[model samples]
Target: MNQHVASGGTAEAIAALVSRFGDRALTGLSVRDLHAHDESHHPASRPDIVVFPNSTEEVAEIAAIANRYRVPIVPFGAGSGLEGGAIPVAGGISLDTSRLDRILDIRPDDMIVRVEAGVRRQEMNRQLRDTGLFFPVDPGADASIGGMVSTGASGTNAVRFGVMRENVLGLTVVTADGRIVRTGSLARKSSSGYDLTRLFVGSEGTLGIVTEVILRLHPIPDAVSAIAGFQTLAGAVSAVIDIKRAGLSIGRVELLDEALVAVINRHETLALAPLPTLFFEFHGNPESIATLSDVIAAIVADHGGTPLRWAKNADEARRIWETRRVGLGWAKAERPGAQSWPTDVCVPLSSLADAVLDTHADIRASQIPAYIVGHVGDGNFHCVFMSDPDDAQEQAEVHRLAGRIVVRALAVGGTATGEHGVGLGKRAFQEAEHGAEAVALMRTLKVALDPLNILNPGKILPELADPEHSN
Candidate 1:
């Protein structure tokens, strides 16, 4: 009834997992060594057992078994996360939620949809295409909606549409002690007690295992216009602030650092200036769209940024946008078998240019071949560094580099993580970023919901921060 580390590389402990979940759970699971980590430089640590649960009831049953043994349970999504959220650090049970892939209902009138935890963002988007509605919160990877909501996911669209916390309507969760509870409702507004959905949405699966999610959807844009251009780093960021100030109903506003742009050019097979860029997408009626584009172009030109360059037509727009959609994965595939350290730090809107320029300066000094990308309209950015985990020095450098960036973000009144939730990677910054009082409240909530600390332990909250010392 205690957490087990992956000390034994033998099958004896693995037999225990097979004994409970049957051969199907044990047979043909991902390579055990591979399962030991997420998409980060976190050293690989295997779970004592891995169980695949196919439904909410099955998840509850699995939870009961895990509780009986008092083994730690780490819920996993697509493993595309940079924060190591899905890594089973305590070596107990890596509960796989990929099998619960079902879309329960699409309430067009209410503009909401209910889905199982295993549903991927792009997969759900495919299903919603026909209804002229789509889920807007995409976290780069086709991350599972359940996982997205679990980590309060956000991405390019977040600048306009908000994150998972703003989009999710309700959740069906299995508590640590094997209790089934449905939180929140389909209603748009709830003066309900505690606002439970928001709590679990960004809880990083520490409170409970979310089995199902009800999410708000947006009407498919009547037309999407994407414009990509290169500019000096300072100019690109300034242009983004200007666009927001002008009140453009933009759908996606992104910035790619010059170093990152070169990678995109090589990996994505496109040629452009090797300078920081601002990618813009406007969604609205034709009249507003034209006027807004003109306003945005003039602003960019004023700041020495490139003029708006778009696809000649809608078909070309889709093609151009598709390139950006797969940008992260494309970059990942560039270096085979390497893990990416994605740093997401968001600064105050007014100080965005300063924050970005400072971070860029740091990146330039680092040895890591890093690429910077962001949902810049919101002053949130990601610098993805590809590195081999086996390389000790490189990994250590990444850790230090990432840590400095976090400190910088906190200095600017920003967070350690902007969109990607605090998983294993950001745990070190817990005290430095959030003060003593705030962190204590978080710990109190964690204890209240998951008394045994069985649900995704060792994430978000630091191991044991001296509240008063705050480090």
Candidate 2:
């Protein structure tokens, strides 16, 4: 649609892929529709064909064929992305990576694992259960490793373990021209020539399609999780700042506003008090964890929070974390038939209280059924707006409200997107968040890596600026 493909070239490319992949290359409407859009509120756009490659070689071949025909290649993972990163807006080839599932190698000694793009986070952790080490970058969605890498995803554990960018040590990428290139290394640190791994880590499959990832793993430490309720959301946020300032080794720190806690209680069938709450997980040896818990308990008390309630056992801890994981789902259940516009923004630690409070105020004023939940440890938070799908005015208002949130974060020295990459949903804010020149440079890099504009086009960057025309 955007000249990424030649007239009738998509059909030819599909024919070529089908010939190579047999039944794995699907043209059925249902599959196309499934790959059309992600979890975002963006409108769906089905791909002309969905190709599943079982190996990096096959992925390279798909790229080669797509490049030859000028067909756009949209690499799709689990489609759990909040932004429209996996959406095939140009509708050419949706290169679904599910068939490439493989845990190629696990160096338990090195605390690293190499996996194909299709391996899900939970599945990887399950495999690592016996190893005493686990992949810690949990984006909560059981998202595929490739999708997590593409979106630069992070979750509750990110405050301690870091995001995809830091955890991902190496990658096997199939570039736009179908070249198989390996970036980064197994070694922990390097003064390498170019950090291509990072470039592709959050490129959202625009620069290239990631086929395999080598991820850093962490030893499963003795974890103790607790919940603290507060009278106001601001108090909970302030407690988070104090916990961080105290230099506590907090594994996970989350904040759920009173409304969201109520939703979680009703949906999860838990009778926890419907109050602004802070959920925390501390990791260390048992003695250290005990001391850390005591320190945290005192900090929360100082900030007007309820006494910390420790999870009695692992099952209780799982349930506590699970509640945070399925927050979006429970929110949807809270208001049946309402669509959710899940948006997130991260601010500096000092601005966390103001950001959460101001955003909560915005939600109350809008009169929209929205809930606030965030991984507040790193000053990142999400507001899930549940609006009637048929209510066009409500949809527009939510979009504007989300924009204001992003603007607020940017003003306070924060990112437009904390983890969800600059997919279609956040494209408009790129320039506002990073200046026009920086965005233009991003375009130049995109063009240099993907000259044909055939790799996940119309994503990340709102519009492609002609490098030759740029100053």
Candidate 3:
């Protein structure tokens, strides 16, 4: 190890790091500021320096140096996270994985793909197009696989394909002390030791930095598509529960409240019914898909929902999904000079209607400009509040409403976050959600893996970042 770099802080640390990786180690204000925050309401805080490591060896070396110096290391992917997971709150080094983008191997027979952490979801799927296989966890954003795994993200496809926990077969991680560790394997199932792959999946870079990923792939369905429209939010959620309870093989199910539909109308001319609507997809052969669609349509009609609006062609299907894909951006830009405060909570399928209705009431009572959208099939939803960050009073009210949302979900046996990890915003609720002993165990694990609190310090555990407890 370079002792001077290991012992250095700001300037000395930058010099030492630059020497090791040449100009790849950067300390310019613009570069440091760029790695500050994700899509959260948290204020941006710059890191002392940023480094781009192209290979796992470089990442391990950087980790070793950070461990030696007791400096915080924040692993950064595409920075598409909703929480402040990528933010460098302690002003240390931002280790960016963008340069490590690569598809290492594609095993068509095994239905598995090995890739560098920096590979984006869309890029990987594009490459697998001709292979008759595809990676299914699509978290809306073209997020890096590393970042998605870090947050344990799930999107529309999750309703059928499952989340990162199910799709990720294994991982290659660089531990706190710069040691490379491999966990899990390409095998379908393992009765081996601890399930370390899962332990690190939603760790948000708190335990280790993921360098490579082995993902389980699914065969592309012969008939893949969706259709949607509902009369009321409650009705839509009810239909979702009925479908799930009936064991309908729905590929994906998405819910968009009237407010979000209006926002989409303003952004683009889809001319969809400005009402609570659900988007759904069906897989398998044409005969099976038609049957499933008919069954779901009957359920929808039972709830007073309108007839499903089927997408006529692949282009039209893309356009419909595109509207949902860009809903966040459209909402953020709907109100000029305002920032988006995006939040999510998950509830039991049975409690979804109540959770959503109650949360919508809370938002309305708070009188904030907000829109609701979600993957309702699995009881996960998001509320995007538009407000000026400079307006302290408005911001406070928005957060207060968000807290109510989380409380409601927890009451119904749900998590404070579904896909968004507990970066800083949701750390306060982890204890309440998991209880005292569970939270303590989490902290103990953090300390065991990163004694110096050098890996993404000031995250997950409130105590680590608290100056009063940071001695």
TM-score on alpha carbons, each prediction: 0.91, 0.96, 0.96
lDDT of 2 at 158: 92
Per-residue lDDT over 1-471 for candidate 1, one digit per residue giving the tens place of the 0 to 100 score: 122221333254345557756853543436445557876666677766667887888788767766666667788877777778888776677777788899999888899999999889898999988998999987767788878987888988898889888888899999988888898999987998988888898887788999999999999886666555655788888877877888878788888777666767886545656777777778888887877777877888898877677656787777666767777667777778777888889888877778777777877887767778888888888878887767889888887887877888898799888878888778878888888888888888887877666777667887653333211
| Ranked by lDDT, top first | 2, 3, 1
- Please list the C-alpha lDDT of all candidates, in the order they appear: 0.77, 0.88, 0.86
lDDT of 2 at 455: 90
Let me know the TM-score candidate 3 reaches against the reference structure. 0.96
**Residue range 374-415, candidate 3, lDDT tens digits:** 899889999889988889999888888899899989987899
TM-score ranking from best to worst? Answer: 2, 3, 1
How many steric overlaps does candidate 2 have?
0
Off-target runs (Cα >4 Å) in candidate 3 are: 1-8, 223-226, 464-471
Q: Which regions in candidate 1 have their CA more than 4 angstroms from the true location?
A: 1-21, 27-31, 228-230, 267-270, 326-338, 465-471
| Lowest summed lDDT window (length 10), candidate 2 | 462-471
